[model samples]
Target: MINLRQAVFYEYVDDGVVEIFDRYKWGLRRLGVNFSQDLLETIVYCPHNLENTFMAFCSWVLWLKSKGEKTNPEILSETLMQALKSDRGWIPYDYQKDFLAQHLDILESPQLSLWKAAGQQLGERLRNRIISDISEEGKINFHPNSILTDEEKEKIEAFKVYIDQLYL
Candidate 1:
């Protein structure tokens, strides 16, 4: 089981030479948000591969609920899909359509409330994670070759704004 990440970057410092870097892992770390450990382990071991879809759906559910909106399957699905299309330049989209369909089914199932509760917990973690990441920006390591360009920095800031809107 992979433990939850606690830092924005994974670094190996060998006499000031940097090696072994992964931007994908860095992005996941920066997001620093995920389902509970049990749920994450279950998703990883599940017969099907729908982890991203399930996460997006659950997070959207949590977002809507946090905004005090009563959400249904249709609303949850549509809202998530729209966010994916509109604000997902930074998010990966390699999951199959069946993955999303599975989440839609879960949304309509008797387990919806349970998942929402999990999502609520995740949202709280995400909120705190975002705050800490921003506050402790100076502590985050950057690879020598991985410095952000102006445009990349802008995009990251844009993503921060978008995520802030979602969770705020």
Candidate 2:
């Protein structure tokens, strides 16, 4: 799992130095971005009103993809929120609060806002999704497969399949 990484590290440090500290584990490839398909699959399936929240988010993706331009985090976030609110006349304040809280903190670097960057965040968010930690959150970081009705599950599965094809 770590041959390349080890070689790189040892190239700088001698064998004796490494023996002095054997507990450390070197992992190659820092955690920076996520895969496009993972985020698409998660976004459509992660609860928060399929018609309103899900469709609005999808529209944001489609819109960004069409533009094919780079954007900083601030503009991207504002544009996405504006699009969502404009589509429904009004977006719930609770959802907005939760969305920012859940997604913004980890964006230490400037966000790309393109479909790929937006999609990349989905995996980290899903893996980090915790019921106890985000009870008050109204949107983002949600997956409730066991709690869904059969019809709801079908809708989520179908949407995930559709988006998966598009991303590929």
Candidate 3:
């Protein structure tokens, strides 16, 4: 079993590789070996190069596996979404969008409670951003705006679809 508590990233950077603490590296290495076989296709099709960020994501997959969840693209995408959420106050770096935890505990576990919190936070953040954008636009003209661009229309439709999937 992988030990989440021992997943540590060192400050020293060597050739852009994140150096895991000596003791923790063993567990991570074992996790990596197991992950490489099952998630090889995921890594191949991923847009970004698999680095420490990918490993961090694998940790969540490992956790989900421990809970009997199967490894699949949808599960991986959902886990990535939860990891990248801005509302996870425990993450120190604002730009860090991975599931690499500074410290692991029951509260930090990627379980039902954490997923719910992340989803709520995401909704709140989007609502606030929309309100802020409207406020910055100044006076409300209350006029019918120009026809939506194809991209804009697609985005709106996509958001609606996302909302529907949120409950599924």
Candidate 4:
């Protein structure tokens, strides 16, 4: 099982998932807006890249720190929607570089390498576990029409819950 209390960027990202939902919930509640858990989950895990995820997370941290002073639903939705947009020609920028450096410039410094390494390890673990659980009895055989059984799906969902806990 993954440890949520670990002082690692990946762990922080996991916590960010939880924090984002909490912030969204509070923001919507304050705005008197109705929302569903599925929508929250979609946005929470919607970012397709590490940079976007970090950006969304940074926004979450900022919003959380703001307390109830600035809980505009329109602004909240816009910020989160921007985070989910595809990065076209925008040059990648690590805004959280100061908080958890990921710049892999060997000539510059290596302190941020720890975050990079931890991210890689955590990502691999998540990928491997998902693949293993989705396979049939540890076998990788699958046809184009592969469809998970109800029991298999349930188990996969359970595994996801376990993985989600790693974020908190």
TM-score against native, each model = 0.23, 0.20, 0.22, 0.26
- In model 1, the runs with Cα more than 4 Å from the true position are 1-35, 49-52, 55-59, 62-138, 141-168
lDDT of 3: 0.38
Evaluate residue 101 in candidate 4 and report its C-alpha lDDT on the 0 to 100 scale.
Answer: 35
**TM-score of decoy 2:** 0.20
User: lDDT by residue for model 1 over 61-104, one digit each (tens)?
Assistant: 44455578875544443443343344331132444334434434
Name the candidate, 2 or 4, with the larger lDDT value. Answer: 4
Candidate 1 or 3, higher lDDT? 3
lDDT of 3 by residue, 39-154 (tens): 33332333333344444554555666667875665555545444434243122233233233532322222233223333464454433333222211122121245455586456
Q: Can you write out model 2's per-residue Cα lDDT over 1-168, one digit (the tens) per residue?
A: 222224442234433323311211110001112223333233223333323443334334334444785545445444433443443433335544455345432222211222233345334333233222221111223455446557645654554565455335
**Candidate with better lDDT, 1 vs 2:** 1
lDDT of 2 at 75: 52
Please report, in order, the local distance difference test score of every candidate based on alpha carbons: 0.36, 0.34, 0.38, 0.40
Residue pairs with clashing backbones, model 4: none
All candidates in order of TM-score, best leading: 4, 1, 3, 2
Highest TM-score among the candidates is held by which one? 4
